[model samples]
Target: MFHVAALGELLIDFTPVGLSNAKNPIFEQNPGGAPANVLALVSKLGKKTAFLGMVGQDQFGLFLKEVLEKNNINVSGLKISEKFQTTLAFVHLDKSGDRTFSFYRNLGADMMLNASDVNYEVIKEAKIFHFGSVSMTEEPVRAASIKAAMFATENGSIISFDPNYRPLLWSSVEEAKKIIGIGVKLADILKVSEEELELITGKIDVAVGADMLFREGVKVVLVTLGKRGCYYKYTGGEGYVDGYAVNAIDTTGAGDAFLGAFLYQICDMKMDELCGLNKNDFKRIIDFSNAAGALATTRTGAIPALPSIDEIHNIRLTR
Candidate 1:
């Protein structure tokens, strides 16, 4: 059985190759999508992982499948749709390596997935079921993802949610908030960035944001603070894991890497160990995740930038 199973989009990221030449900038193709990136990170860390989603029967879809297969993630849940085209995103990185996205996904293949498309057996077998908010922007796929999350919870699987909010994807901010709030209530572990927290709670403080999520029924709340590190709060405990010092080249996939590593670590531990973990244990997990995120920044692309367990250990040792 796989340790984690993720359901959502799988697509191509076209990143600008040269900063100086805007008019004639080269574009490099990379496999991405929050769920796909998480699967890649977990697989790279030597965890058994599977991905469930739909891709178009196009060259881009084939490319995404090949990437996941090469990374050792189970591709059985991936389906190719004939009616819709593959999704594509154009990513532009600023001087600080933070990215701005221009997406072309007008009813893309991924959004076409319905509840009928989900493989219940795969969800039942996994220890953790992870997903993101982008998949909830549309109809049938949104309903399918929510149903999957509910099923996973009922079947004794821990649910992980990352509300990777994109304003342009939803009909309105109010709608996005309502949908993401439902996810927050359903998730056992919820990850959010500073911007996402502000968007959801209209609060800038991590403590306040974490408190709001806890009240929403999330057992664990992770607030990622770019280079400063991550803040975590659970039932009756809360604290921060200081960030690792590194020269980051790109910030893409840092959050995905962090979430994947944290979940993988929890899965690797025994159920008793996981349940018995105290504040120190939580800190250790966050520290490892922070290292994974920081190391990811030193490299360029998203999936390719994720550090292996050895690399994470070495980086931690040296730091």
Candidate 2:
């Protein structure tokens, strides 16, 4: 059985590398897409993991598949679609090294995933199944996303959701909330930014927002507060973990790294052990994840920024 499996988009993020002589932005292609980044870290941590997604039958798509395979993640469920080109996102960064995405994905390959294209055989054996809201924004792909989540549930795999909201991908805030609510209900665990909490739950406070999700059936709610760290609320527990200090160069995939590390820790424990785990147990997990997230920012790109288990462990030890 696999430790984790994720079903979602796989694409290339063209991030600003530097300025050209003429002051135009110089972009570098990085293999990205949230769920893919999570699985990359999971595989790096020595877990048996697989990725299920669609990509264009082109060079970019081939590059992504190769990257995942090189990370030691199973790609049996990955498909190459001839109908659409691979999705692309041009990332713009602020002075703080934070990013914004302008996508080139109208009817893109990642959005063309049909429910039939999903390989349930791989998902059923996973200990955890992870996804995000980006895949649910469009049709056909939306159905595929829901089907995979349900299939994972029916097969007894844990459901993990990250609402990696990108405003450029949605038509309106109302539509995003309406669709994301469906995923919130399906997930056992959720990860969202403070802005996403307000957007998704209409609650400004982190605890209030988490409480809103709990009422909707989420077992655990993780609010990622960037440099302030992460806030978590579960059935009988709630607390905040302080984020690690780092000289962040690029913050592209930090949240995904945090999530991958958190899930890896969860899967490392027996289910009953996790259930019986206390606030301290949860704290250790979140602390390790916070360090992983912080270290990810010290590097550039998504997959490239992912930290190894030892790297995270050493940081936690020294800090």
| Per-model TM-score versus the true fold | 0.96, 0.97
Sum up the clashes in candidate 1.
Answer: 0
lDDT of 1 at 260: 89
- Model 2, residue 1: distance off in Å is 1.7
Model 1: per-residue Cα lDDT over 28-114, one tens digit each? 998889998988898898889999999999999999999999999999999899999889988888888898888899989999999
- Residues 34-60 of candidate 2 have per-residue lDDT tens digits of 999999998898899999989999999
After superposition, the stretches of candidate 1 with alpha carbons farther than 4 Å from their true spots are 19-23, 269-275
- Candidate 2's TM-score reads 0.97
Task: Give the Cα lDDT of each candidate.
Answer: 0.89, 0.90
> Looking at candidate 1, what is the lDDT of residue 159?
88
Clashing pairs in model 1, backbone N/Cα/C closer than 3 A: none
